[model samples]
Target: MGVIGLLMRPSELMALVKLKKQIGVWKRRSAAQEKDADWEFCFDMLNKVSRSFAIVIEQLGDELRNAICVFYLVLRGLDTVEDDMAIDNATKARLLLSFHDMIEEEGWDLHYGYKDEKVLLEEFDRVVRAYRSLKPQYRATIKDITRRMAEGMQKFTEMEVTKIADYDLYCHYVAGLVGIGLSQLFSGSGLEDQGIAQDEALSNHMGLFLQKTNIIRDFLEDHEDYNEETDTRRVFWPKQIWGKYTDKLENFTFGKNQEQAVACLNHMVTDALRHLPYSIEYLSNISDEQNFLFCAIPQVMAAHTLALCYANPDVFKGKIRKNLGECRNTHPVKIRKGLSAKLMLETTDMQATLSILEDAIDSLADKISPTDPSARETIEKVQLCRDLIVQGRRSSSPSSKVASTWRQETSKATSYVAEQCTVPLLVLLFGITAAVDVPQALGSAWWQSEAVPAKLGPVHVWLTSLALAFYSLTLLLLTRGAALSWCKALSAAQVAMTAAEVVFSPVVGLSVVVQALPKLLLAAMLPSCAKQRHSRQLFAKQQAAMGNRRVLRPRPIKADKSY
Candidate 1:
């Protein structure tokens, strides 16, 4: 990964952890109140959802988890600022500034919102205390998350503009940075490069994906409670894309623009899905278990969002959550044996990007450390470390696009070898009864002549021909299998890309190329030549052009399930 790419991703992970912890503390604090049962339940569900993230941190050691936790705990203060409508703007500004001051001074005042301030405050205090108990590094990360939150809030309150751009920025302030943080953490794990640097673009897309999904899902409530007259409504749907569907989207308030919103929603999902495969490489590289939590939760959440988009409209009416019960019921158990791992290693493309994230989390089970900090400053340092790592990596190599191309090419080559193999085999079978048994004829070709060679008898020649035919037939069967595998794999990739219309424009006439034509050709071709490496290469070039290389981004694109 490039310097900023690594740094950007790490920031994403850190931001995500902070968000989750803040939510966790809020949920815990709110659950104590008798009147807020429903709220508590929602928070609890969210917390349950958060546990899936535990997989990321599972291997990173306690310092990383504490670092993340502390950051979120402190940032929860700022979230309280935005979430609590009762708080006046002036006080919110003061509190946010105070947080900024705490970062500079190395200490913070925790008494401002202690009593009747809300569950978040109490939860924040607890996390802060827990953070203070950790090592300095962890404490620093906590402080950093808080500081960033403070800075973000400062920007939010001081802003004179409220454009759709502002909402996008706000989402970034709130969530996009998390995407950046995670990318760093992922790089730290040191996986074989799957274009991690170029992943910055993908990372940004991922952040937008998650945030946009949130915005779409929360459109009704935000409009009801948080809408500002000065600001335009719902920046989640960009003007360019919305122009095509606005007429159809008019009345779709609570799941109103269900169809169109899903189209837009999928733009982000597919973006996430595109990068999601790298999580496997990341997990394989990491030695710590705690890191898994950071990886798994977001993946599960992303998957849940995708499911919601594809599901009923009720998902938009309220939070569509994947709770512990639901998650457990559906969760896949990783096949941990060497044989299974070996098999998995051979089929990286087949593994769902979602599984990559979960697997990263799953891999963290054996590596938890207890000394980690869950504070803001430490999280910030972690962010800085990530930034440093990305920078360092970038110093070694400059072009993300070129690197991505190499990785894609490598993937294609490996897939080709795994999918295709040429084996010679017989195409015909017949019994020949020699009229002149054991005759020695010199005129015609020995096998066809029903004659024995001068040195060997006719019987020996017949036996040799039979053996050659058997070998050829065996080779033919193997070749047929290999050719069939290559054809299927190639088509599958195309089908998947086409399905992801959210990420790429669909080729108007490529369906036949990826579908009917290849299969037809495979069936009609001579078995011996069908699996020829040259033929496979020629076909693969076309598949890569159609499936991997970018074409123009589709206008008003919608995701399909072509796969």
Candidate 2:
């Protein structure tokens, strides 16, 4: 079965079908008459090395597609060298620094690496030949990036990365350069704005975001077994971040430290997400639809992967890749729509933009039944986006607008106080019921004369006391944010107290039922309260995990008169 075959959802299946159809069209159009054996070999290598990328690369127009295929293979060869630990440090460093120069050397290749990548290294002459066949500008761009990346890899291979900056530098060398190179290719192909190609900061962020995600996701695999001979692990997580959490990077994966591990993972995800706005900006600037998709597929996949990694303990246990079906099924286009809505809101009237967003969300719900879990999540995220916009607008206004904000805050405070007091109110009611029943149970003439059972006095007192104790305990648990199981148990005890009252005295039983109703309702709501508490705890943990790192809260858009 293909990757998409793993837990295939209907929507995802449809998306995969559409993607395949698009790929088919590109393949048909790019089909060469009397195909060159060298070009064919390059594509074959792409499929073998990275099938996922092959799908996207194949969708490119003929010229750009071929260029990218060769570019990918060249980088794959370079990466193979960096990954192969068996190569002596001296040889690896030398080859890396000179690898770019060898592109024009004819018949240049490396034979030593992991089994899967070794073939690419050995057949790299074909990649270099294809590179040479590209236009001079494309060739120069590829060579420039390759040379710089090789040097960076050489430096890191020989030294330890003890700081976050060093880690970013290493990522820049390995992946950031690829982003720069691709931008140059896009610009050289006359498909994207030339200015975008020169925006190194944006390009660097694009690469760093992707590289950090890969490093974070592959933490377990990368640190599994250090080179036994060298007693060193192949890790990209900056010591600056992980060192604060644990003495050994591997400890984060331990069962006892899973919480810390998840926090650390969330922190890394947050760092990666910082680049999202720039990435969105990059996408917005792209004019070529196919090129945009080409760039978009990976960015969307990165976001989906980060979501999977968030608070996921299994990431430390082993590999946790999204199934092909799941990856294919993700609605990245919806995310793009969300970004557009945000941009529009920032540049248009707030109320008008929000109305448009609401309509879009409703339309989305109509198409994908709100009953669907995915649809619900999407709707929730979009609504959150809308709320964020409203909050931004409110926060940005002058002092005259402060009155409305104060009113909203006051109302929220009132609701919060009311919610918090429910348990205490239940406790008070339980105490009152117990007190009231004592007088009745003591055979007070007025109470006993009304059809009271002759033998019910002690039983009434016992039931009331038991209920009082149960309600007090339930209140304690609710205040402590105890599990739902405990709340249910307390509820069961209340039910028993009601049953005893009913059997002994109908009037008292009716009164007990009325008094116990609120407690029962509160018990029922505890589960939801527990859920909210859990969410708050998770958020707190995430913040703690981030430590001194500034969390990226979305900023409000300034209203534009342009609606």
Candidate 3:
């Protein structure tokens, strides 16, 4: 789910049109035949979103649309099974297993004339037929994803209690895996190289981000459903974490536990943010038509939604949302801007954009602030860190070379600092041994003196020395890292600072440094003994110099290459 994905072919659209047309016809007929206004409304509501997807697909050439439509229907069928209460667990299990069997048995029947036969099995069959008709290359993608979905579904069991991990698996099965499939479609659509590794990362992460969003959004609904007197229950939130925070899971419903709910929402949002970069990268990889609606729309929607969620605290109010109008107006403009700015992805402006978007999402759950107090401190810190990183890159003799090297060296330095910090203190205890002293009679021959026992002396010294050395290294490493981190933080703060010229001018930088004097004084007042342990080592100077010089060097320039 972490990979970038390819595009679907142009020809695939034909199949999608056919399947959608059938679903449309089936909907009309069923609405008339069953006379169930509520049922029709439900499908219509779902289709409102699905139709947007269809429009995007239709715009793609037929070949891609056809394949996507089939996959879409198959997914819809699974969703129907999961949602439909009329069917027994036995039937649901059978249907889930049948999906896997259908992949191998091209003409296999998944629904087998069950309740809601027309909506589930009929639509599923149409997609299957369309899939079989696709060229072998497209067929292969469908088959692979279908198999993954089936594998994920078949693993579900009625006899066991559901775990958080299982819910994650379920998300992977239904949505994250689809993200992977869609990525492949995007890659294969003949837009660009659509490198497998990058696409795979995008595919997986996008799906995960979306799935996590759904979980966060659905917390209220899930909580309500879980409490119903039914055989099934929702346990999407991990019991360990939820139990630690609150006694009753029901408290998580929107109104009563808004703050707690938001905290849980934050956890999922944080998890999604971890994957946001990949989602961006994945969208960036897509070329032409597929990029617009498929890549751009969802990416922007999710981002805006995240921003809204962050800015507002009412997400627990049944169904908190940033309506479509907001998405419609904001996304196109942002995407237009994004496409142009994509080349300088690692630049400050780019980072600022991401930070802004993240803040926007977070702002939904909290109050929007021009100078939000909660994140102001963190923002300032990160700004300084990045600025130092940028400054270290710009300070070389030629300046241009420094500028060029800034990207490469700073990254290496930052990574080195982080990497060195992560090494365990135990690693420095490699060559330890132990011995002890004992008293002996003076008359005894020197050689026959009572042997000193081989106690844990050497070992203790080695361990203690190592611990001290590691502690020392950690302090030094932290100082340099903190300095670099501070540098970036200052750089970030400069943007948010009230007066840019004033902040960057000699006076403000000096003032900021002065304000930081307490921390600086504390750091300096700590004993110089921290760096003394390795003083006699052969390469101690070299190591210290190397570590020091890295901070003074340039950063890695991630060249913007064609997707």
Candidate 4:
């Protein structure tokens, strides 16, 4: 129905043609992978649940293709139970808590209420059959994530999303876990670098970004989703946010509070935008083309969805906004068929994707109101996205063939040098902060060597104490796997203090200046810590995910893997 309305526009019509061709290719690719009745049913269920995900899932290698298909279905089945209002809270909670085990039980089935989901759940044994056929590592990854997610869902089922932190944790459980599970599957398949799986924090952002967009865009639908018998509405919009806009969540849907509502909506959109840079970094690290597209297409689509939803009134309207004239509904909040198709075509082209992302960032920035409480935050996040886009544009440029070749070669060698130096450099910073056998800068030099005992001045001692305090706080919050902003601020302050010591310490000689240079370069290098969201959460988050247990030390892969 939406596609029929979109056909009037020439560009959309062209996009539709291209989209059809792509589907044809995917279908041809899928035919070879389909085995028997059980697999066919699973694939059929995949299509019904998500055409976008199923198409990409089918294009994967034979072994991986089955594992991912089963993984997605298991997660989707869990989600269906969570979303189905027909189930009583007790029943839902019980089901969610045990969903991980249910996948292995061939007799497990339930009537989840949604038409498509009813079929998926009722015939879930087929999915279980397919899942058992997967590699043991793949099955382990799927089971571990499903267990964690189900526990999370059951927990959240009993609470309201009252705070932004609550909202993030909820999103982490439902969506972020999907990202982590996929990464585990990817690495377990040996199709991607182990670092990709090890970087659970990065994976979490990718899912959060997409999940938050869905939460924001479906505002009207989720808002209106009331169950009279249970006397509950499945509202995921955090009260900490919506409470400031209007006294009631449904007030956003009314005309009287439209002004305040749009501000609230823009605030949510901006919060989602904060995750974009991390998503880009995760996608940039994908080495396989199919894997890249599998992640990239949906990510690009989410960015466009945010572009369409930014301060748009239709989000509060109770319908899918359709594209009719110039594929016009893109602005009205529904990501249209043609535009998604066009975005898929552009996913492989970094510059094209950046242009789309830049447009989305512009859409978000242009709507920031000075009067809104979150206006400054929205502006800052928007600018961050733009900055990253600018960097992407520069990197994707191909005009200088000679320079590009030289850069690739130099980057290879420089990358190796960085690999060897990185650990020792980190150790030096830790050693200095720890007051381990190391020289303290006297604010005028690395140390006054003339002093026989080298007892430090109060200023030097204080600076060391301050840096140590910052390190301790940063590490502590990192251990808790919370307070991302705190992590960034502390890390940034630590870097700045190091820089101050390097610059303020008098360059007593060329030897002194030379000694300070690496510290200065290390300071410069650590900006990525500030630039990337959840930088400290990489190990800490994985630690927390593994039941607050310690993480295994990662074996280093090639430092300069391709985007």
Best by lDDT: 4
Scored against the true structure, residue 85 in model 4 reaches a CA lDDT of 72
Among all windows of 10 consecutive residues in model 3, the one with the lowest summed lDDT is 1-10
User: Cα lDDT for residue 133, model 2?
Assistant: 87
**Candidate 4 structure quality by residue, lDDT tens digits, 1-563:** 56544643456678878878987887778787648898899988999988889977877777588888999999999988888776888889889988888887786788774667779999898999988888899999999999999999998888989998899899999999899999988888788999999988889888999999999987776756666687888789998888878889777773447888888888898889878988877876787777877888888889889977876777876543322200112233567777777777766645556666775675455445456677667666766677776565455546633444464467556645643454456566666556531354443344445532355556556667776665555445544544343533454465567656554443346655665566555543332332232333443443343353332332222212111
TM-score of 1: 0.42
Q: What's the count of clashing pairs in each model shown?
A: 84, 1, 96, 0
Q: Write the per-residue lDDT of candidate 2 for residues 195-240, one digit (tens) a residue.
A: 8788776777778777887887777766654566677777888777
Which parts of model 3 are misplaced by more than 4 Å? 1-49, 103-120, 156-168, 197-199, 226-230, 311-313, 319-563
Cα RMSD (angstroms) for every candidate in the order listed: 19.3, 13.9, 23.5, 21.1
Q: Assess each prediction's global lDDT (C-alpha) against the native.
A: 0.40, 0.63, 0.46, 0.71
Clashing pairs in 4: none
- What order do candidates take by TM-score, descending? 4, 2, 3, 1
Compare candidates 3 and 4 on TM-score and give the better one.
4
TM-score of 4: 0.68
Q: Estimate TM-scores for all models.
A: 0.42, 0.60, 0.49, 0.68
